[model samples]
Target chain A: MNPIRQDFPAFDGLARPLHFLDNAATSQICRPALEALVRFETDDRSNVKRGVYARAERASVAFDDARKAAMEFLNAPSPEEIVFTSGATLGLNTAAHILQERLQPGDVILVSLLEHHSNLVPWQLAAERRGASLRAIPVTDGGRLDLERLDELADRVRIVAVTHASNVTGAITDVARLRSFCDATGALLVLDGAQRAAHGPLDVQELGCDLYAFSGHKCFGPTGIGVLWGRYDLLDAAPPFLGGGEMIRRVSLERSTFAPPPHRYEAGTPPIGGAIALGAALEWSMAQDWDRLGAQERELAGRMLDGLASLPGCRIYGDTGTQQRIGVVSFELEDVHAHDVCQLLDSDHGVMLRGGHHCAQPLMERFDTVATVRASLAPYNDGADVDALLNGLEAVRRKLA
Target chain B: MNDALYDQAIIAEARSRTGAGRLDAPTVTAECDNPLCGDRITVDLAVQDGAISDLAHKTRGCLLTQASASLLARYAKGGDVAAAGELRAAIDAFLKGQEDERFAILTPVRNAKSRWDCVTLPFQALADALADLEKRG
Candidate 1:
């Protein structure tokens, strides 16, 4: 067992052991992040950037440090490129809202079939508002983006929005290849990093994406705080998504001059404590050996996939091949509803799994099933968790069958 | 073997229900889909003398939903459309942990709070079918 599991309070708080397999939905916060949140709230609680008092100055410094931490986490060129929003949903929506100005009528905004609704709906609304068309990259039978079809939309595609790792399938997109494709086509790439952020460290420059967004809650940080990393040059040119206090440099009744790149995008009092805790979360994550963590997650995922495949009527979704996937596995038992599967697992064995369309209806249509029971792994999970899941699933099949 | 949600009676009803098909030309038919879980139930009714003479259903859902549809089909054959419409309220009460005698077979589902819709979707569709019957008349 990894010693990091002891750092999470949830494992110790429960009377009985809980096999938390819903890491894709949201991860349990680590001790450092939780303490950071409490420390900010109890001691240094003050609104940031607007006050001249000592505590307020401390709060402002903490807030700016959070931005710097996030910038370093993403390996973004500068702290100016990081814009704080509520979560990935707001970050993607802000990206779409800003990009709408550059879109012309008949222009295409290409999205993948495997995107969570957060990534898909924003681009859809952007297309509708700008009179640009929206297109979806088809998913192959193995539940990966069909990269060969990139040339088909090369002429008119202004933006290519895709998930770095699918929340449903766990298939990691080849973003480096995608970057080459976008470069060849003169299209900007927007990567949704909500599911990928916790799995490993990310370098925005290496990925060559114009914009990247991720939610804090999904990555062992506090909720209501997320980062939107855009290239500084692009953010400077894009219009603001929201208008209010703190985002403006100077405001009069007649007109207001907006603040520079990041501050202009972050309108109003942001999530102060949550952002600080997120910084702590990233710092804790950076201090760890990610190669070991990745290997542990992959081993857990492999154990789960191999166990599920051996079952009589199980149908696992996505690239069942062990190579390029994160620790997420989605599957369905024959003639069994996913909700029932999950409910039984919860009630019987204290195993928690996510059961639904996973907010990817297009991908659901591709699989011709409405929903699947998903068990996502994190660094904290061990082989015992996989055994618990397998035992619970076997019991469910025997009883329900 | 000791699963409270999928007991022997519920599993038996789910597996052996004769209401697993559609009526060719029914008096009224209604379909409802639980978008959250993608569970769908379609109810077909054949009314005679203002009462349901025959009830058939097709369900693509969990065992609870299939069992609920089976129980509803078994009881709704001789019941009037008005009584059939009232099953929704009765099932809703049962799902809320209340002991409604009308839907007593579905008592197992009361404990599964997150899956209440699975047990009630079929009844909701039956209610809709009854309403459609009244609208046509």
Candidate 2:
């Protein structure tokens, strides 16, 4: 974690030793990303696509460069396939909206129990609006998608939307299985890539997904910026989600024509600086040695799982193994409430943890738990972070349970 | 930080489980959920005139929520709806860090602003119950 920790500002010069184990919520911004944000704001503070001056042209160039970076990071076929959004929530909403017209009554959108609310609700709205329906792919006790049941569930599924990686259980979905299902049924695949984006560069083409949505902040970029990538053919055929300046081809009193895919989706002025920063963040991520970082993450995750299981009355939700999972771990102590556990950890142990339904209420129900304490790891987190979390849980149990 | 927010007294109050049930025959009942954390409080009341003859609570939440439920029972068990009204003010004061002898155990909670709803959910259900009863009559 040495060189990785040095690049993140959150670990710098802390008065009290702070262990940030809440990276699933938002990772700390890296130096390059933050510098990119500042550079955009200070050096080129002008509107994109609508200005002629040098600063405006510079801003526009930087903005498009960021788009190219994102396109390359996701391994998207073209830069035009990338649409900058406010965050994953909005990106998913745009995905739903763009795909809405294709859905008709009796059509189904298959989502899994692993979804964050951002991934679940927008499709629900789309289903409801189109007189279509949503069917959840039941999660196994291990918290992975019960993909064995996919044969029965995919009959009416015009679209299969699911998480690339679960924020709660840390289980990575078996996308190959889903890819097969979608291919056989001709159901479009849409991935909520929020959690998986943090781990490494994505290959949407390789994953066999038509559209993908992910937040920048969770990938060491700024908030209020995210990316939605869709195939050119699908995007070209889709309706405009938002109608405004950059998104329109021409406007009249009664009728207005829309621009192409990405622009048609990104209405109004985009988060210029935020998008630039996210690109820088993606570039920074691509520059890292994922093989080394990934092993470090897995080792830390195993320790967290084993340590939590060792504690009396402690239960780890989802897969307890390091295989096919990210470093995000959610667990609970008997009798002690999740919020209380988190509060005590932060106040007493200086460990920052997130506790709640994790915006996946259905997943919580799947686990038959009220709330859970989640410790999500990033590249900068080390053994000490895992130690503090385990120690904090022990202290919390002694005090409360 | 020296004064632990989850001190002994608060723990005891939560452990007591005072008013931690449902009234079999209730004049009115209301449920409230702290949407942020999914902490829930269901309050049942037996009212005679404008007074709450008895009350019970089912709080499926954290320690602060349970402790607050217990405190709501302790102070407002036999009191009128107006007295329950005053308790809401007291909770507001406690949250504002103002001194209330009975609720002093929760003073430390003022600094933990995110947990404020946990301490207020029971009282909010009671308020809703009272308002619902009024609407019924």
Fnat for each model: 0.81, 0.52
Instruction: Tell me the tens digit of each residue's lDDT in model 2 across A1-401.
Output: 45688888877888887799999999999999999999989999999988999999999999999999999999998999999999899989988988889998999999989899999999999999999999999999998999999998877899999999999999999999999999899999999999999999989999999899999999999999999999998889988887788899999999999998789988899999999999999999999999999999999999999999999999999889999999999999999999888888988888889999999999988898779999999999899989999998998899889
How many residue pairs clash per model?
0, 0
User: For model 2, how does the per-residue alpha-carbon lDDT over B72-136 read when each residue is reduced to its tens digit?
Assistant: 99988898788787787789877897778888888888887878888988888888887887788
Candidate 1 residue lDDT tens string, A1-401: 55787888777756787789999999999888899999999989999988899999988998899999999899999999999999999999988987889999999999989999999999999999889988888998888999888788677999999999999999999998889988888899999999999886789998999999999998889999999999888899886779998789899999988999899998889999999999988988888899888888888888899999999899999877768989999999997789888988988998999999999988998999899999998888998899999999999898775
Q: After superposition, how far is residue A382 of candidate 1 from its true place, in Å?
A: 0.6
Best by DockQ: 2
Off by over 4 Å in 1: B1-3
lDDT of 2 at A285: 97
lDDT of each structure?
A: 0.88, 0.91
| Candidate 1, CAPRI quality class derived from DockQ | medium
Candidate 2 Cα errors over 4 Å, as ranges:
none
